[model samples]
Target: MFHFRRSTAVACLALAPLVAQAQINVDSISQDALVSTPESVDCTLTDGSTATCLEITVKYVPENLEVGPFCPAMIDDIGGIWDWDGDEAGLYRIDAAFLTMLDEMGYHFYDEDGTVHVFDIRVEGPTDDNECISGSFDEAVEMTMLIPTTPVMADAPVSLGTVAKVGVSLSGVPVFADAPSALDTGHMPALDVCAGHVDPGGWYHYHGTATDLDTVYDHAGVEGSCANAIQDAKVQFGYAFDGFAIMGSLEHDGSVPRDLDECGGHVDGDTYHYHASEEFPNLPTCLVGLQAEDNYSTNAAGGIGAEGKGPGGQGGRPDFAAMAEALGVDEQLLARTLEEAGGPQADLAAVAAVLGVDEDALRAALPQRP
Candidate 1:
């Protein structure tokens, strides 16, 4: 069954806004350093959605290009690196036994082919429609995702299916739905200790909250680096496809909000928004507002385009030299990094270190993951 941490009366009062305001300022989005080249579009929402709506396009790298000291360690024989903490406390390295168990459980990973994918993500809305949009979480959108074993309660609760692109993070990485795709056979595809991982197309994305490791405690009983990596208040991490802001577990006053709906959302007077949790399925269990189409797309560099063609076209490898040039790294270094880290299954932190560069630099130099 799905589980949620309900807030007490005191906590709710602490999180309530001190003053009610007009609609959320979509223009304020430009203030976020992670968002760039914001352009507006007028959209007519059909299917009984809403009337007043706006769409915007922004350019960003797929990974958290801001904070780091990424150290994705290579797992021997396991196609990809181990970067995520399965237990929420520390990192878990997927070994042969773990892989075997996951495989038995019906989860799989695929071999990498030494290519990176990137894209210009489009976001829209904040349309005054308060009506919640309903859809099955099991429906596959981008990639064929595995159904998560975890139970969820919503307007239409269903097994967790893979979502290629869910939302965008404040650090500029794409937040994928909270399950691994069936196409992956590595230990954990696109999931790392920081709650993010690289996709097969060579783009890094998040599957959960970006700050999950912030509250992590090690053997010494001290706060982890993730805690110190808070560049801004966790109030607003990113935006969902529907155009509503995705906040963290805490409120502006540092307290959890009560009365979250089944979709992990609640209304504060006029403003409606979603919240990230501290537990499994760290993001909203489902979208409470209407979502727009064509919010996400891949570039011809390595992503699947309108014609359903990716990288080298139909099921082909990407151009290594072109990818290296786009990433601004030496072709030889890029090739060696892929070879050592296992082709497209390369670990950013491990590969970056091997090439004598920082993770941020390497990520900045790379193309966007599709």
Candidate 2:
């Protein structure tokens, strides 16, 4: 529900230097590396609408390894711990609360039982010992999403509600939704300065496109700054679940286009594509194109997407005690706070104010009650 906007002047200022110094790597990416053949599938939108979509499955690892030096230093700065137990076994860990929020939002992670867990810190790292804390490298995941062959706009702009995953980055990292689920309103996640962090599942994904490609380029032994690493001509970073291309902010001519819609989309020739912006919601804010069916649920055959039931299953309320423990708060205090604010019908901000914390923090801390 947060309306985000950025100063055009500031965006122009930040991009000008990068545009001049950075060059997108032309040989690094190819169509075959990122996308698969489009298949006709039935999909459902967030609004409970259904459509016949072109499902496109993509590799979890990007073709371009040069865009990621994703280092431990960056992770440490963001409060993430690698080799969490001090053993070199390569298990990563994050705040229990962060993991819990992901579950509440209906995103599932591989639990130790090989089923699913709501809050645990055992993240598996990439098999190849790369500098970046890339997850599931040995058995790379193939994710599939539905997109309409013909683009269509919704009657009203669909809100990107507590989005779990947005799209995949060109480097093959998963792109998370804009707002930080672990924090309250107006607060942001402690992401690596490069705009990415390691998930509890050990997946190294992005929340935006503010990464410094130079570090990645240097680590991969490729030449160029992060800015110039992506080809300036095409600037295709990745693809949305909706099957449209996700491009950088600048056009082929080195200028930000002015004709983009709310979802950062515009019809380029006959093709619909999205542009990454220099704002809070750096990527496209919503799916302007048609969406595919819910693939996050266990019922979905692939079960590789983020649009399904979480560990405890959808609609079943979470336990307050477990929720309180995950948020690092006292159960009694949380209950009292909720009661004073009107029990199950309390306003989140009101409860947070009474408890002297950010609304988002309080929200993330609370269980998903009916």
Top TM-score model: 1
Per-residue CA lDDT of model 2 for 103-151, tens digit only, reads: 4544323243432222211232122211122322323445554445444
For candidate 1, give the lDDT.
0.42
After superposition, which runs of candidate 1 have C-alpha atoms over 4 Å from their true positions?
A: 1-36, 46-56, 60-160, 181-187, 216-234, 300-370
Worst 10 residues of 2 by lDDT: 12-21
- Could you tell me which 10 consecutive residues in candidate 1 have the lowest summed lDDT? 130-139
Candidate 2 clashes: the total is 17
lDDT (tens digit, per residue) of candidate 1 on 1-370: 1111222112111223332323334454433333234444444332333233333333333222443222222223322223233323223333444444444554432113311211111111112111011111111122211111111112332222334345665555567665431122222233334555433343445666665434332322332334322533356876665555778777778777889866677776656667776554467665533344445554322322212432222344445578666666688657544432423333566666656667786666554434
How close to the true structure is residue 263 of candidate 1, measured as C-alpha lDDT? 61
Q: Candidates' TM-scores?
A: 0.50, 0.48
